[model samples]
Structures are given as structure tokens and as C-alpha cells.
Target: MPPEDRSTPRARRPLRHLRAAWPVVVTFIRSWGLMALLVAGGLAIAYRFVAPPPPATLRIATGPGEDSAYSVAVARYAEALRGQGFAVELVASEGSVRNLELLRDRRVDFALVQGGVAEAGRGAGLVSLGSVFFEPAWVFLRRDAGIGRLPDARGRRVAIGPEGSGTRVLALALLEANAVPADAIIASPLAGAAAAAALLAGEVDAAVFVSATPGQGIGTLMRAPDRAMLVDFEERAGAYATLLPALTPVRLPRSGFSLPEDLPAEDIVMLAPAAALLAQADVHPQLVSLFIRILQAAHRGRQVFAPEGRFPSALNQDVPLHPDAARWYERGPTFLQSWLPFWVAVTVERLWVLIIPLVTLGLPLIRFAPPIYTWQMESRVLRYYDDLRRIEEEAAAARDRAARDAVEAKLKALDTKVATLGIPSGYGALLYALRRDIAFVRDAVRTLRRG
Candidate 1:
């Protein structure tokens, strides 16, 4: 044959083989298609139970303005989260009260809230990572006001922070505890720098501030010792702490802010509340873990009031601790979390339950499926054995040569049907055995015909 003709036969040979394979393909589908569908369905149902991937974006509520310590701290959090492939939106708010409102409304995923701001029957469906820092009640008074203690501010002008502010809430609580009526002081709605400015300008007799020691307003007031003095809650600190479960008795040692200048000449006792990082109850565990790690790194150090490794603590939290955060604090990160990247670790953790069941049940099913399929295919070829035996008996009982020949012809037709039947190549041994039996029957029939 010419080269071209030889190539044509080679190409046509593939087509013939494909045509021959059509029946085997059909038979295999009949056997295994249902099994494939079942496995797929099982996987889909398992997936439903798995924890969903963490959200790509997170919204956080922080204190008002870029200058606020809350905003600055949350800005750092946003940067860290962004580096780990999350998009963080920082929403500035009036204070902890507004932050709580944003969190309750589901308008933000996380918020920095003061310990005492979340009142009874109001803080539902929220959880805390932990208290990150202390926000002390810094009551700055002008020298002319002659205010030696919290109650002495009665009937005097007081800047009690703005509306929807944690400072305002705490100030009212402390004043009420001191037997100072709400109407007794001329309350000013100014806060932070405005409150500090008002107190410095002699516009207000006293200003109540709830903030970290490093806050700008507190720093500004501390710098001017001649003009303002911080009130000492020495006599009632223990009593106030008992009255409000959120408040902790904190003492600032002599000259805590400035030792050389003898700024605070004596130890100043104050009632301090912790600032907690709050999140929705249903926040993703991965995000919770990440935030907890960030908070530990940020706050687990010595501060003006707290000792080294004292903060990022589960202590003094107004809201319940997040389960994941609690776990992190108790037992640290999981083994996979310690080794793998953030998303990879979370993915594996989420799917681990599904994987265990699949391995346990699926292995046995996989081993059993091939044997079941083999038996089904072999039965297709073996069912004709009974017909072959009946033909052999008819040949043996033939009354004449013509009768024997008719029996032989019937046997030949049966053999042809068996040969033409479509069976998979894997079952060729069964097909050959059936063919050999048919030949045996033919030989016996021919011998009877000769007799």
C-alpha cells in the first residue's frame, strides 16, 4: 500500500475502535453513573455544614476625629488587616456609646467601647475580644473652683462631655453616686480638646474626661499644673468601684506624668474603666483570632497605669468574651494556625469535619464499588448458559438425522447471538468462557447427527 493509503487505514482504525467502545461506555454509565451522582450530592451537603469563608471587608467604629486615640489605634488595626488581605473601613463615631449603637445596628463589624457605656439590658448580641486599655475618669478643675473632691463640683459649671459619649455617661454615673443632682451642676456638652480648652480658659469650673493616660486632652491639662488640678477620688474610690462593677480603683503615683516637675504632688486615686474591643456575636472565628493577636501585640505592654503584660486581659469586660478570643487567650493558636497562612489555616479548620467523615465512609465504598460493577457485567454474559445446556439436551434426544441437524442449527444461532452481544473489554474472560461452552455444545450435536 502507498504511504498515503496506509495513513488512511491508521486514521480509520481509530474510528472503528471508537465505534466498538460505544457499547462499553454505555454499560459503564449504567453501572456507575448513579454512584457518581450520589458522591457529588454527599459533598454538596457536607459543604453546607462547613464554615463559610471569612468576609473580605470589615467595618470598624472608632472614636471621633483622626486625633482621637481610638481612631489612631483602629487605623493601625486597619493597616495590619489590610496587609493580611482584608479591606477595613474605619467609621468615626462620637464615642463608645455611638460605637455600641453602630455595632448593635450591624452597621459595623467591630467597635471600641468603654466598659461602663454598655448599660444593663442594652448590650445584646455583642462580644468582646478583651479590655485593651484603661480609660480613667480625669476630673480636671480650675484652682479658683476650690474643688477638692468629686462632690465639691456641685453647683459649679462642669464640661461633662458631648451627647452620645462614654465620658458623659460615666460622668453622670459618678455625679449621681456622689449625691450630686443632675441639675446641680451647669453641665456643658463639650468633650476632649473642647472640654480641655474650656477648663483652661476658665469657662468651666471642672471638666470630666474618660480617656487613656496618653490622650491629647489629658496631656494638655497635665502640662498646665498652675491653672488646673486633677481631683483625687481617694476617699470614695473603693466605694465607687463597688457601686459600679465596671470601675477599677487605679492610683497614679506622685508626679506620675512628670517626676522632675512634681506635677501630681501626691498619689491621685481615680475610678477607671477599661476600653474593650467589641464585635458582633456572629463574627468569623478567623477574624476574631486575627484581631485578638493584633490586640495582644498592641496592648500587652507596660502603660502608665498597667504593669507590663497586664493588658489585653479578659478582666473588666462589660460584654461577654468572644468564644474564639477566649480560646486564643486560654490555649493560643491551633497547630494548623501556627504553621499555615491565615486563609489556608482557616480553610482547613472549617473543612476538617467534612474531611474526616468522607475518609472514614468513602474508603470502604470505593473498595466495594469495583466488585459490584464486575458482578453486574459478568451476569450480562453468563445468563445465556442455561439456553446452551437446553440446546445440548435437545441434540441428544434427536429422533432422526434431520432433527439433529435442526438442533445443531439452533445451537449455531445461539452462538452467533452470544458473539454479537456487546460486553466491556474488562469482561473478556467471561465472554470467551461462554463462547467455549457454545462450541462444546456444537461438537456434541455433530456426533449425534452422524450416528
Candidate 2:
């Protein structure tokens, strides 16, 4: 204390002292650039792998008339598609045969066609949305006439549908099964209101009406008491198969016709094939998914023809499914469809799903990067001196016990804090060297105290 040491201990400023640590600066710059490159590369790859949304409108070919099943179905389907921002156009065709023809020509995006008619025309370009209902072969015979099977009508006058109609295709196949000579069976080419009026007026001996009930033509006839009898197919199941391989024996249960009055005496077995929603193979996947969702939802409550909750099944059918339709039905539809969002949300979701890959791939990299960024920033810090050097400097330069004690406490705190910091496992040697130096300095300080 004789001459208070003019030199006083001062806090070390690592940042100011080592501002030009070029190696650490270069490492930091390299790491930041590499992280950016990794993020961008990952995002670009994800964008390429992502799937896009389908087109906005679907052009569907319905039936010849709005009264027909295909027309009815497409109309209802259009309503469901509104939420998806899809506009459906219902195009007119002569019948199922013409529907298949337009489909072959790629004239339409989707069509509803009778099952067996599309068999011979089957190619890679078609896919099924599911059977909407049974397109039954309805044989309306005069109430007084005694006939049961197709063979009974061999020599009798009959009304088959017009040339290209689905009715004609089904009628010929059925009549031929009964071994009726095409020339002998008097064929009347009539349909719809004309056919229904003809049968009521008794112009034709029998009318072959193919429709869903309360079908426009058939239902009109059914409402008339004893005008025509629905011919049962229980006896001709084997014959139906021989003529039309696609035919399956279905039952018009007595109660199904009229729940209260019970028009049918008993369950009547009848031949049937499923009507399918056929689409071109090239139809986009998102559209196919959207179409199936709408079609399935539309037919959900209909249990009269196809099984309830089973109308949109991808079961037996002639046309192959559009690849997109197959993909959607295979995995089943999404929550958006089942949940039925509003138009705005549905549109946003369709777009959102497309961008999902970008977000999924990008988010993890973004969330995982902050700690890495902080480490990269701090990597440039200059290394702190070992505690022994700091303590020695303090003892040599410190003027009073208070200053010496304060420096000793600060050194101890620095040592404790550094020890707790998680450095690389290989840095144990550096820690051991620091501890050894600290012990040596403490011993030297104690030895000098006895002086």
C-alpha cells in the first residue's frame, strides 16, 4: 500500500479485442449459406413432387331426355359439385349406346351408361364411378295375356326400344336368350311417352320398358290398375345369364313397389345390370376423386335399386375406371367431401391440398433452423482465457483486498459457468487443462499469503 499501484484490474472485452477473428467469421458465413441452400433445395424438390388440383368443370353426357335416369343423376350431381367449384355440363345422347360411342370418341368427360352395352366397347380409356342403380328389364304384358318368360313372346307382337337405345340392346339380348327368331318377333321401335301411351292404348301386344320405378314410363304404367303386369325373372335366371353375362337376378320385393298397399303379391326376382358412371381414362385424378365424392354422396340414401350406402361401390361393371377415379375410390374419398365444406372453403382446400407438399417439406426445416442459426452466430466468439491466468493477473495488479476478492469471485463464477456450457465431448482435455491451471494458481496464492 506504500504507493497505491496505479495500474488497476480491468474487465476483458473479448468481442472488441478479437473483432478480426477471420477464421470464425468465414465459418459462420459458410454455415449460413449452406443452411440457405439446404432450405431452398428441399423446397424445390417438394414442389416437383406435389400433385395439382383438377380442372374446374366436368362435361358429362347424360341420357336422351331429362326424364331419363342419366339426366336425373347428372342434374343432382351438378348440385353437389358446386361446393367444389366445379361446373357440370349435361350433354344429351341418343341412349346408352350413343353414350358409349361419344365416350369412345372422347367427346365427353363422363357418361352414365347401362352395364352390358359397354362390354364389347371396353378399352383402356374408361373407368367406373360405381353403379347408380339397377337398369331393370321391365316386360309389361297385357293383364289378360298368359305369358311368363321371354320365349312366350316368340311369336307375339312386342315393342323393343328404338335402334340405338339401351332398351333395344337389352331387349334383343333378352329375346335372343329365349331363342326367339329376330325375324319372327315383331319389334316396335318406341320409347318414353310414346311407348307408355302405346301400351295403354293396346297398340303393341307387349312393351319392354327399362327404367327405375317410379320410373317415368314404367311408373306411369304401374299407376294404371291391371294395365300391365311386371314379368318376374325368377324362372329365367339361367336364361338371362346365357344371353347377358352381366345380368344378375335381382328382387323387386313386394313392399318395395308400394310400402303401404303392397302391390306385389311376393318378392319378384328380376334380371338386372348396374348403371355405371363412366369416365375417360385421361380424366384428371382430382376430378375423378371429386366426381366419386359427389356421386357417392348423391346416391347415399337411395336403397331402392343399389344397396343403401353401396351405390358408389366399384364393383361389377363393364367400363374400366378412369385412372384418376380408380385412384380416389381405391383409397376412398377425403374428409373435405365427407364433411361438405362451403364453396369458398372447399375451393381453398382443393388448392391447399396441392400446396401441402411445399408446407410439409418447408415447415420442418424452418422450425429446426433457429438453434442452428444461433450456434452459427455464436461460433465467432473468441475463446475465454483459463481461470489461472485471470487469477494471477488479478493478484499481481489488484490494489486492495476488496478488489482482489471481487476478481477471485468473478473468476470462480466464470469457471462454473464455462463448465456448465455444453461444448463438444472431445473438449474434455481443454477442461482438464483449465482445472489443473486453476489448482496451481490457488496453491501459489495460498503460499504467498504466508509471506
Candidate 3:
């Protein structure tokens, strides 16, 4: 690049006399130090507060609506999130296993995952908003099979669930606990409506339905034309719950599905695992908070298992809760959060951490910088004044003409230097005063010469 044209720019006269030894460094600090500090502080606060805006839309992995509670609940969450200016997109998947996979791969922002899908541990990089609802283990068998207990299905063909499903996981665990030989049962890969269809068609002797909420498939099985009987887990419900830390004991009241028709003959005891709202660890905190609020509005009611306002819970979650969700659960909302708009409140909360420290340090600097800069400029004038006084004293004591002439030469040199000294126009009075004193010394030296 060609050199910049300084020729036509405003001319700055050279300040040789008053230039300090470390002029560039000292001049820059004195001219722009405070402004640079203020600009940097403002930018720091902006980055902390506004860099991660709430996403306009988020994709969530939910299970097929025909058979999974996740589908139903996710739709409700989508509605709630939309009302708050967020677009919630639903991506249907196989089940909790696929949901976890989607979250880990970053294919989706959120997921409704069943507890205990974390065989070794919660999928890497995943965190939860909270447990939303219980997924009961519902087992159904042919009415004539007369199978009253879980162990009785040892030799009978059973449809666990499809590949990569939490239902398959729980079913295998339960049957294994009953000592049912894996080789003895015809475990099918069919899940959801397919599994229910297979059981009704007599392709499998029984089917196990594991879902966070009651889906159409479970309801279809119960109301099947062949009258398939729902196997009561009464005998082994507690045992299953005890063996599986994730499972909770639940009682499904008789005819809860159809009060007048009395769908089931008696109350059924079962073990169920709760489904949690999960996200990646690095998801924006503001988005997490917004997700929690949507979860709250969508889940603030009595589920088939839990009491009203008991869901969206932080405690006892299978995965660790997102930090923001935990804070919301522990302390409702912050002060500004309660009064101001959500974005405004969040921006303030995020900035205060940086803003508070800058304010604490900046006030002292603002008070002291100007005075220190003034003292530096004044020292230049004082040094010249001291030199002039020494020259005047020597001139007054000189007895010979040669000595007075040398002192006069020194006075003229000092006068020339004072004339060239540079300072802001505001200090013009001080500059003029020093020149007047130099003239006085010059006249005294001439008088000594004449004497």
C-alpha cells in the first residue's frame, strides 16, 4: 500500500523543548487512556450480556405420536414455547434411546428421554431440565392365556419393543429378573402400533408397553376387539421397583381409562420410570431458562402418576439438571426477572457481574487521572524557572566582562527555548509569565556588563 498522505492533513508544529523523554508512551496514556478504558468496559459488558440471544427456534426429539407420551407432551411444550416467541420444532424418533442419540449428536436441541436409558451414565454432554412424567410398564396378554404373573410368560412368545427403545430395555430387565430364559420367549423388534397390532393378531402371546404418558397404542390394546387382558404387576411391582433404582411404584386405579365401562377388573400395581427433559451441556443458558418456563406451563397439572404442580422437578432426576433450571426451581425468579421483561431481565443479570467490577475500579481512576496529568505538564515550566534563577544569581556575582557576556549568552539561549515550549492554549498564561522572567534576567546581565 502507498504511504498515507500526511501532507494535506492538519500540521502539528514540532514541540522540541517541552517534549518529555518518553513522549510517545506518556502522550498516548495522557490523551486517550481514560477513553480506551471506558470503551473496553462497555464492550466487555455487551459481550457478557447480549452475545447469546435466545434462539428463534429449537428442535426437540420426540417419539412417534401414535404410541409415545413424549409426542403428546412435546406438542404441548411446542405450543407453550411458541406463545413466548420461540418456535419449537418436533423431530419424531424411535424412542428414548434414539432421543438420547439425537441430543448427543447435536441433531436436536432438546429431548424427552426416559430414565435409565443411561445404562452406564447419562449420555455424554447431556443435562436435564427435570423429570416431567412417569412412564409405566404396561403388560398385556391374550385373555385365554390365563397368565396371572410375570414368571408365567417364561416359555410364551412376547414382544418386548423395537430396536433401540427404552421399552425393550425395561422389558428385558423385568423378564430376566423373573428368570425367564431369553431363548424361551420370541422377543419381537416391533414397537408402538406395530407391537400392539402383532399382539392382537396373535403373532405374539403378549406385549409390554413402556411410555411416559398413555398413548393411543396403549389405549388401543386395552380396548382391543379381542379383549386382551392387562396383566396386573401386583405380585412383582415392588420387586421390580426395588431392583431398578429408576423405577417408581405406581397404582393404576380400576377403570381410570373408562369410568363407566370399568376397563380393568381391579387396581393394577406397576413399576414406572420418569421421563426427563434433556439438553446438551453447552446449550445457551437463556434458552434453557425459556425451555423450563415452557415445561412449567405445559406440565403444571396432575399426571396419571404425579400430583398437580409436581412435575418439572429438579430433585431425583436421572440426569443432572441444567443449572438455570435448578435456579428457577429453587428460587422462583430473580428480582428484575419478576418485574421486567424476560430478555431485559436476563441482559441485566448477565451484565451486572462485569459492570459491577468495572464501576468499582473506574470511579477512583476518574477522580485522580486529570490532576496527575496537570502536574506533569506544570513540571516542565518549573524546571525552566529554576534554571533561569541560577543564571540570574551568577550574573549578579560576576565581576569581569567575560563572565557577564557568557551569562548573557546563556540567558538568550534560555529565552529561545522558552519561546519554543509547547503546551495547550489553556496554559498560555504560564508560558508568557516564564518568558517575561527570562527578559528580566537578560536585562540584569547587560547592566552588569555596562558596570
Candidate maximizing lDDT: 1
Which regions of candidate 1 deviate over 4 angstroms?
A: 1-12, 19-23, 46-52, 253-255, 259-267, 352-361, 400-429
The better candidate by TM-score, 2 or 3, is 3
Candidate 1's TM-score:
0.86
TM-score of each: 0.86, 0.66, 0.71
Ranking by lDDT: 1, 3, 2
Q: Give lDDT tens digits, candidate 1, residues 1-451.
A: 0123354567697775577567767767765775666666677788888988899999999897786768877988888899889998988799989999999999999999988888695678999988888888998889877887778888999999888899898998998898998899999998878888999998999998887765777778888888899888888777898889999988889888788878678899888899999988999988888888788778888987889888888889887888888888889878988889888898889988777557755766677677777877787788898888788788778889888888888888888777766677678888888888888889887876666
Model 2: weakest 10-residue lDDT segment is: 1-10
Alpha-carbon error at 270 in model 2, in Å? 1.9
lDDT assessment of candidate 1: 0.84
TM-score of 2: 0.66
Q: Which digits, one per residue and each the tens of the lDDT, describe model 3 over residues 1-451? A: 1233466434432332235235434754874596567757765765665445667888988785544578878888888777777777888898888898899889999998888886477576788888888888888887666666778887888888877788888888888888886776878877667878887887888889897566666878878736587777777667777777888878888887678878655787778888898898888887777777777877878888888998888855777788878898998866887788777877776666666556665666666677766766677677898899899898888989988888988998888777655566666788778888888888877876776
lDDT of the candidates, in the order given? 0.84, 0.69, 0.77
At residue 18, candidate 1 shows an lDDT of 78
RMSD of each: 4.1, 9.5, 7.5
Best by TM-score: 1
